[model samples]
Target: MDNNILILSEGMQTSIQDLGRKGYRAYGVPIAGAMDKYSAILANKLLNNDEKLPVMEMTYTGPKILFEDATLLVITGADMSPKINDKPIKMNVLYEVKTSDVLSFGKLKSGARTYLGVKGGFLTEKKLDSYSFYEGITSQSRVNKGDRLRIENYEAGMELYSSKIKVKRSHFEAKKLEVTKGPEFHRLTKKHREYLFSKQFKIGSLNDRMGCQLKNKFPPIKDQEIITSSTIPGTVQLTPSGKLIIMMRDCPTTGGYPRILQLTDMAINQLAQKKENDMFKFDLESSFDFLGRLVFRFKD
Candidate 1:
């Protein structure tokens, strides 16, 4: 009846993340869900848990786990060579872990982040009706070494399930991330704006929950002054240092940087699929691309 997952060892940082709160970014509340949101959904869906359930968000690596009792679990996003008791378990599939059978994760093999989910949700302090926002939240971290995740027993004795879902290689090979022209699209120089939508830019390394910086050719922004108004996750702000910062899951609500272009929801999801140094180009448009972006949709 009682099945709680205990953390035995951690990698760099891992924390409990749900789907994150909505309608709060206006108040500077970032939607702090799993970095790879689709991966989390896959984990949750594999275990029949609600999409909003708190799952372990593991970045780069994951923690060793000890189950208080038998439990069901799944993992998705990024290849971290996750194994159970020295035996590798296929990712994107449901699996069983007996009590004392440790679950461990190794260094990142393909992607940057991964999600580990159990049949029941992770027991963590829920603020604003969610257990996300680890950076601002002082007490918890995205799964680290020596952490514990309390869960409940969903399946009784002799429950064994195993299957692997191999995400198509093309999904990982995507190179283009489309975006809508920013609200201040008209503010940019005619030439600079034109060059932006057509030219391809490399996704930089200065990226995290906060945002992502795209490399620029000595950017078009020469000044540093601007009126701070509203912003969202898709906002692309240009800093004085000539870096284009694309806001992500945990971005600030307002900033003085010159807003360049805003990624559409589809593009944002596509952005999550991007690897370091991935070169991408976005087309400029007068309106948002509302439909026909199925590939960019984050799916389980």
Candidate 2:
């Protein structure tokens, strides 16, 4: 049936994600977008779809899928061992499926999220200037069993397939993330600053869409009081007991804690690839110059 191109057999936390909604962060709306933008981009590239198309951003593993019609698709993210009708499927490369061929991915082998792209992209509604943020009022929620995702039918001789796509994967090995000093950097004592940088910190399990917990190896920071202020992603906020925490993609629009260090964009991307039980180090750079790059080109 051309009425639908893709069918999600299971949609646990399946939300339509785009490139995220900027400019609305000032109004307290968190910059909601794909958690693993790299994988999303890879999936789109495999299907010859737009980079901003709404794909199934599945966390952990993913639900089963059954297509009512044949279409070209790709899967990216954690190695979930996707299978079609009990037959293993190749990841990152596009595949043409027949009707009623069941597709399912096993539990997460590594990483935190997976991206699934459909031919011609997933048809979804948008708000503001984006179709990514589904936390608020949005047309699609996380994929669940028996959910039908509508897709556009293509004319003959317009099918695009890719059995080989340039898909790059992150190399995981107890990672070390380099960071720059933050706004409240001076609030720390000489001893505290040294400990904050050099000591080994442990990642706690209470991580989610908001932030993650890090156990402080050194002494605690006594009663530190700081006014609430604007915070960006990669901000490492400190708690009362000298613990470290990092803000993720869906972090609050504002936070009051002191941000001791900030991870670089590359480091954040690496952290986004990490899953539970994966630990990384926080390192320091000797010097940094913010004026090195001119980054004022804003897009809509």
Candidate 3:
């Protein structure tokens, strides 16, 4: 008997994602994956599954799923107020579902995306050596209503499990984003450079998996156009029109805009949890400077 989950109602945006695809960017393929990799990893770890297991990434809302077999699973990242058979469940803890059990959600309490991971992970098709779903690179990009997600079956008579490890409350807060100097950081005029650090940027409605569009407040950089060059997730680019775009997991491999800054991995994780109109300040620091602070903080 095969174990599967039937999607009754796909919420705002639901897609399967993992860590990301690597070593294929030179071929024009973006490393599409979970926007909040930290939470995704947490969900998998709670269930004792592989760290790279593909999990469902639900944004703003969550999907309604009906299980076809007994299974162990966990929800992390956003708190969408998930429920099983009309019983409210908490996040960061494992839960067991019986056959024909219905899982649904209520209002989104925090964060931008929620991650759901079944024990042993979902069985999805892989492309270019990854299970991450990218529009043009995967068999399908988003989960739709009525989609069936195959899952690994648990052993018969296996004991159900739960956890008490609550994901840190700080995961949902977006205040200061740590950044390092980019290749073009030094090219900016003194005033513009100072403005970048002093200004607070609001996440615009144009934000998507490809990149985060931030509403700019200061003057535009002069002669910001640049030659096309390699780009990666966390790269902050400034366009000619004074718009600021921070590349995300699904961003293209290269861009022509002036790369102004690069976010630290922790900052990228924090930024991914932000929603439209969310405000955040930029905290500029170099890698070496950050290392010095870390060493000082932990000195014997």
Q: Could you give me the TM-score of model 1 versus the true structure?
A: 0.86
Q: Write one digit per residue (lDDT tens) for candidate 1, span 1-300.
A: 445667777675567778876777766777777666777887887777788898887666677888777778888877799998989877798877777888888766776778888877776777777888456653655555555556865665444455567776544555566677676666677777767877888888887777888876634655557889678777988777777889887777788887778876546655766766888887654433444354356545
Model 3: how large is the Cα RMSD against the reference?
3.0
- lDDT tens readout by residue for model 2, 268-298: 6667667656767678755533333224223
For candidate 2, list the clashing residue pairs, or say none.
9-145, 11-143, 11-144, 13-142, 14-142, 14-143, 18-132
Of candidates 2 and 1, the better by lDDT: 1
In order, candidate lDDTs are 0.73, 0.71, 0.88
lDDT of 1 at 42: 78
Descending-TM-score candidate ranking: 3, 1, 2
In candidate 3, position 269 carries an lDDT of 88
Ranking by lDDT: 3, 1, 2
